[model samples]
Target: MELDDLVEELRARADSARVSQERLGSLLDAVIAVSSDLELAEVLRRIVVAACELVDATYGALGVLGPSGEELVEFVTHGITEEQRAAIGPLPRGHGLLGMVIASPRAQRVPNIGQHPDSYGFPPNHPPMTSFLGAPVRIRDQVFGNLYLTDKRSAPEFSGDDEAVLSALAAAAGVAIENARLYEHSRTQQLWGEVLGDATQALLEGAAQEVVLADVTDAVCRLARADACFVALRQGSDVVVAAASGEGDPAEAPGEVLREPRIRAAMLGPAHIEPGAEGGTRAMLPLALGESPLGVLVAEWAREEPTDHVPHLELLGRSLAVSLGAASARTDRARSELLEDRDRIARDMHDNVIQRLFATGMSLQSAAPMSTPEVRAKLDRAVDELDAAISDIRHTIFALHRVPGGRPLSAEIATVCGDAAVTLGFSPELRMTGPLADVPEDVAAELLAVVREALSNAARHAAASMVNVVVEVADDVSVVVTDDGRGLPEGVSRSGLGNLARRAEGRGGSFSVEPGDGAGTRVHWRVPLASGDGPGT
Candidate 1:
């Protein structure tokens, strides 16, 4: 041991110590950078970027494991162009070298990625890489995911120092991930409360059921960060979409039947999560009360992630179901009371007012025979006026008894035709057959509109001495209105006729106007009872 050699050794030792201190400072900076954001997605992304910078790697990625811990559910990458990614196609699924790190849960360094025996090789159009560095990120004792780096820039291959730094950064990532997740959960809960409160208040205030339901779906879509959401309610033996929100069109949903087995199963049983198109995820939550299955709430995400919020959504849907039941009961009770009050009024008008008017008319008629010729004529006219008044009262009573909300389909059709008689100078003959009560609400509504339009057209244009309206309900609903005045006129605007056709077509049905038995016009409209049924031409 010469003194000169000893001095040189000490100098080299000092340089090594300085380099270690600088690397330690860089590692601290990287940890702070990854922990700064409270957003889970941003945190995951920053962890990957920071790891790449710390190891001087040209490319980096973070692969979060799925629930089964056998595959990657999420892959966040950096240093790759969007075009390059698209060309590379589907993301890695923890195979070969990636799987080795996932299985070992320890730091790995390889001088040549392709030369390794476990290499799965790169996907087509994937950028070339020769070196790799990987580490496992753990939250407490559980391995959350794995981090991989390739093509180290500062050296031929990743050194032990680079591995040590990446391992440390991965540890800090675990803590950041746990914090971000807590924040996300808290935010989700707050949003859930907001949506529930709004829905309950709307129901309590007697908002329309459709309006409240739409609000619920919109709020849920935002809360779940979903691409689309909808609520499907059971209508008799059929399931119809009541409300929809998010990226899809809302108009296409309402009244449309849900035929998917997965959605139908959710309505009868518990919640379910299934794979979606283009690597997305779908969650179906059953909305029920006690033994009654009311509906289902479905949400879709464009990309499946490791985080799950199905339990929260299920709770929200269940609570909404209870609220809906309460609202429905309240509406029914109020309607019942109104109908009772109306019935009482109708009874009073018929019993007291009509009886008095009838008695007055009879007395006037009896007095007519006892008066002089002029006085007799005046008394007879007075009796006739009283009879007309009684007739008016009877019509009023009929209307009062048949309230708007509680009126049956048959009553509605009869009432419309009866009202049209005033304009037509004669009542249009109306005949209805089949289970009118079993028609779905939407179909019934469309049918009523068709009746009104047909009657109006007959009164205005047909100039017919006779008009007949026939409605039949079975596998489908059909409405046929005929007039005996004139056939389809030449060059007449078909806007009103077009409207009828559109309505029928919208419901998978058809409408047409043709010559009747003689010189008259026949307007025929037919629609299916349920969605997805073939057009009832």
Candidate 2:
């Protein structure tokens, strides 16, 4: 061998050695870059970018497998603009070449993607691609997803060295991904604990129910990373949205009844997930106390992927249920105390005060005969005044003895009217006559619902300047709501009107809506008190 030839061979070997060392160093740097981020989303993105940099690929993506391991639930892409992504349409679900990698869980190198037998072709707006490389990413012995690279920048096709580097990068990515998931889970649990504790604490401290409910919705929306969060509570036979927090208006707003049948049905079931009507995912957390469903906590996300906050949401719902039970118990205890006090006061008035007034009036009558004409007239007038006072006291005693089961009917009517005032821009004229306190508990509940629905209709649909609500209980209980607004429209939809009719019919009552005396509309609901049972028997 010649001396010159030997030196030339040594220099070539040195250059090859230097290239290998640089490649190894670059691979190490890529590994470190991916591991740096603890955020699961950010970590997935970095892994894709690092893989592309290591292999000099123009486009790269990491597809996270769904639970079934047959389809991709998340696709993290790099080197693709948002506009291009929009144009690409819906994401690919493990098919053709992609499915081949998912099924085989092995490295794939395709010189021309279109020429490959398993190629399924790209969507309409996808960028041109000829070469493709893919490798499985595994956590422990289980395949988590696939790493895909295409359009190798330095060469027409990726070399064997590129494939080897990507495989190694994917392995490291699995570890980073697992670590990020753990971190996120830990953070989520911690956040959930804090939110639950705060909500429970708020209730224990005697915070108003509305204030605490609002806080819970806000926290759930933020902690669950949901697009919206709301609580629906059972009110009478219907369900109402009690609190809501998020962007735009929720499907059901506070004070509004829930109209979705599916959600209503899910209220009786355990915690579960379902697809949203338009798109995305919905987590339903049923709030129940033993067998009775108190309500449901609904959290929605704009992404189709399943949420990881289901368990947390369930726990929160249970906490809310317990609080609800406590609140109900407190209310019951307060009502019992109030009723007891009222009973005692009535007994005192009837047993002593009324008796004394009756005796005094009788004495005045007896003395009237012995006085002079002028004195007799004065004594008779005084006796008559005493009789009026005794009669008034007797009526008061009767009212004190009457009980309307749950919340008082008058208080509920006032509340409903007050809430409507916010929307109506003015308060409704409320005239409740007769013995409203003597109405059966079930009948009172139905009557209050009628008043609420009527006021709600007037506030929302009627352009009324004045509204009047009159409730009278005689032989029959009657409710008349009148609004001085534009008369009912021709061919008006009957859905809401039908609900009113159904409620009345459920109580063996009659409901009617007609034109007012001159302008606006009038609603009348009447039920026979002695005809039969009241509401929910």
Please write out the lDDT profile of model 2 over residues 52-135, one tens digit for every residue: 999999999999999899999889999999999999999999998899999999999999999999999999999999899999
Q: How do the residues 1-537 of candidate 1 rate in per-residue lDDT, one tens digit apiece?
A: 599999999999999999899888888998999899999999999999999988899999999998888899889999998999999999999999999998899999999999999999998999999999999999999899999999999889999999989999999999999999999889878888888988988897899888898998888777678888889999877889999888754442877887777777889888778887688888878889987999998888888441467877878888899998999888889889988898899899988998988888788888888899999878876765665465446445555555445768898889889988998899999999999988775667667767776776677678899999999988989999999988656744455567668778877788898888867889898987674443222
> In model 2, how large is the Cα lDDT of residue 190?
90
Stretches > 4 Å off in candidate 2: 1-21, 111-116, 122-125, 190-286, 295-310, 344-380, 390-537
The 0-to-1 C-alpha lDDT of every candidate, in the order given, reads 0.84, 0.84
Which is the leading candidate under TM-score? 1
Clashes of each: 0, 0
lDDT of residue 398 for candidate 2? 44
